[model samples]
Target: MAKLWILLLLVCVFAGAQPPERSKAPKVWDEKALAEWATPIAGLNVRPSHIRPKEYYDLPVVSLRTYPVYAPGREPAGYWQRIQSTGPKPLMEKKGSRTATEWIEAGKIAFEEADFFHLRTLDPKYIAEVRNGSLAPSRVLPDGTLFGLRWVPTKQGVALSSSNCSFCHTLYLPDGARVPGAPFRTIAPRPPETFKVWPVFSRLQVELGVLVGSPPFLMPGLSVGARLSQGYGVPWKSDDPHERLKTVTQEEYEQLDLAARSSGGLPRWNGSIIFPAKTPDLIGIQERRYIDHTATHLHRNAGDLMRYAALVTSAEATRFGPHEMGGPDTKRIRARFSDDDLYALARYLYSLTPPANPNPFNESAAAGQRLFQREGCVNCHTPPLYTNNRLTLASGFAVPANAPASLEILPVSVGTDPSLALSTRKGTGYYKIPSLKGVWYRGRYLHDGSLASLEEMFDPSRLQDSHSPGGWRPLGTKTRAVKGHEFGLGLTPAERSQLIAFLRTL
Candidate 1:
């Protein structure tokens, strides 16, 4: 009878060890259903102002071959030759399997391999500079992995490549394991050495644009630069060199300088703003109804993600201008890919799964979970998904009357820095309640990448006037308090540590 009881106990333990059943929720976006739902919302005289143009919907049946064009009247630079010879090729061919899975596989290849931004043109120069010690190697994380940029091999030679979505969303751990769809924390520090490469590269780009003999209207940077200069009150074509100096105050000039420096050595066509947003994780993105920190892009369906990818990679400057101004460029770029390709890309992105948590639940973590619930953190970051997916208004941004009523636009402010939401083109007067599911891998918390770690977030020192400078705070702003998201501030140190541990397990 004792032996029989032991066997039954073992069976019960085995049953308890089995993983819980996952919810059978639909992962893919249903465009028709979304449209049907939106129809009634639209009839109420509230419409989403940022809808993609009709040309986006009418994509080509197959991928088209596209090449980078240089500035007119300039000879082909050595950089152009290196890029043409060694740059990574597009994954989408003229002919391939049209199945959804195959397309997703193709998209995965593209995500890992494609240089959609044409950043690889400077690869040869960058390699030579690093090898010759003219440029310092990018800082490696504690895990011995360089996060910002990596090189991949091509047919001709090695290609210095920037990330696609995979670079931003993937995390490499100390154990030499990679977690796809995790928020990448180990961004390379912006060394001053990297700035030297830009002037040379920009000159080469202009020369190439001239040599390619593209019409002035077709020149890549000209119109965008002009538009940006006008918007920022800089005179790109000013006869007087000191025209900007006369109009702008010293403080305003300094602010502009600070903003420009915030781009971190990237070639930014648009003038920078006070605070740029952190890259969001793609894990469980299908469950997210809104896109971006500002909730500027409404993610009603997979096509919306596709549209977003297309716009960001190519014509992001278009967002600042009227639709008519950027219509031609948008249409031309949209024509390169088919509806199926976009759908497949979205599918591949949605398919990303967060890595398994190596940390097991313990007494401390269990206590922390209780604290998480007790402190009202669950109110905004609700569970199952860990985000209510609602839009909370920033302090200064006023919601327009024409704004869609379907969105959950809340009135309360979280008291975090509102500069990005109030100032940038991506601003829609709202910030999305981000999910906390994979908080273990994410760093530099908050919308603007202000707080470096969960501990710093809970640190009461952040409320003090002499708060230490870190994250993206400029040198002058060091003593400025990092305010807002005061949920865990009142917790005891032990409780805070427990709360952090519990957050890591999520």
Candidate 2:
């Protein structure tokens, strides 16, 4: 009995219970939350409003887990029959009395098992095809479950959910280990070369404009023009590159996706195909002050985190200023997550820890640590959390003198690509200074994921026009300069090695 009690105590410590952090769990779908759900688009400084609470609560609640998808021949005997016979599983139920550790455990399950808001489907055939890219037996986890695809049960029926936080956040190491919440992992089966992805995955209402780059307000069928306009068009910018998407052919759209995919970037809604932002590492998200590469939302508290999940999932607003994204189709509230479910998710995200650091603190790393300090990388990326949690200006962006005091701005430009800052709907005129806590696990760098490695990031050759990008660039393009964030480019080969050694240890 004492040992069992000790084991329970250890579990709570690992969970990092912080009940006081959230004064009291706020009703996630409250009118007050909807009001401040979105931080306005940066330059225009206009917040996009969302659907009313009545509309949000009117939708059905989802608390189901998707069954694990195994490889083609790896399924246990009678497993399919067992899962099919099983009824809907209510994943999280609010209990009158429960420990904080219990809440976090529930959140962890939802984080890994919950189907993405925009990617659920009842089709069985398409679920099997989601693993087409991973034909080898070695591609799956130790338990033989495929990385992302799952068979989720809903009131409608047994459905194959396409993506989850694990889809983008998991780094599938070659040795069969996965680091959940690490950046730049694409486990979803790629759309066909023709760019005609699983059309069945998105039934009329089973998608989000921000998530899949389709039109938000799809009433009848929409043209690629309407889809692109809703997903990437900035009516505020007269010379918006997305305006040309109206005339863009299917082949052209395919090329754009391929280009973005090659470098581990995707043009999410309100973001641009030409200026895609990299998927963020969620391992240390609890320490972050802002969300999105452009700092479009403030990470004030657990309620805000809960709201973010709800926003990206189903409540995204497509309107800005006087311009409407979809002329014919009105904005719709697709689905909603319960307050307890979202709160659980927030706690789970907060409790995530980095995988064990393989790189040791050696003499080289110690010298490199000194170099890191001397180089003044600490101003933006302060230690402990390894980030000051402030927003830095991008070049060519005029900082509004009357900007809100709540926004902590460093006013220093790294001179990176400002297109994601200026042209996209997510543009906040500032980029959130990212933490360097787990760069060793992070395979990609920069706002657009332009570099593939720390060695490549500091390579002066990357600044030259003839240099090839180690990471993703345009599909067929050969060479282009990866400009900006020129720090550590002047280091000698030995010093560079030491610097990277120190960075990996973090």
lDDT of each: 0.54, 0.73
lDDT of 1 by residue, 1-506 (tens): 99999999999999999765422113222344333232111111222223343434443332322222222223245734665565544446534335555656766665554443343444566556533444333443444433344444455565454445565566666565776666554443332233333333334444333111011112344433332333222222134222333355434543443433332322122213335566578888899988777776678877677765654444233332222223233223223344444556677888888888877789999999999899998988899888888988787656666666767876788888776555444445678899988877776678866666789889999888788735556435656688877788999999999999998988
Candidate 2 residue-wise lDDT, 1-506, digit = tens: 99999999999986876454322357777787556546567667777667677777777676576788777667899987887878788668554334668778888887888776445666555654554533333346678776556777666777776556666667765565777777645343331221233344434233433325432344345655566766788988878877888777656765776677655655676788778788888888988988888888778888888978877666666678776665566455465667777888898888989989999999999999999999988877889888899888888887786676778888789998788898888898888889999899777789888788899999999999898886667656789899899889999999999999999999
Global local distance difference test of model 2: 0.73
TM-score of 1: 0.67
Model 1 clashing-pair count: 11
Best by lDDT: 2
Error (Å) of candidate 2 at residue 395 is 0.8
Each prediction's TM-score versus the true structure: 0.67, 0.87
> Could you tell me the lDDT of residue 246 within candidate 2?
77
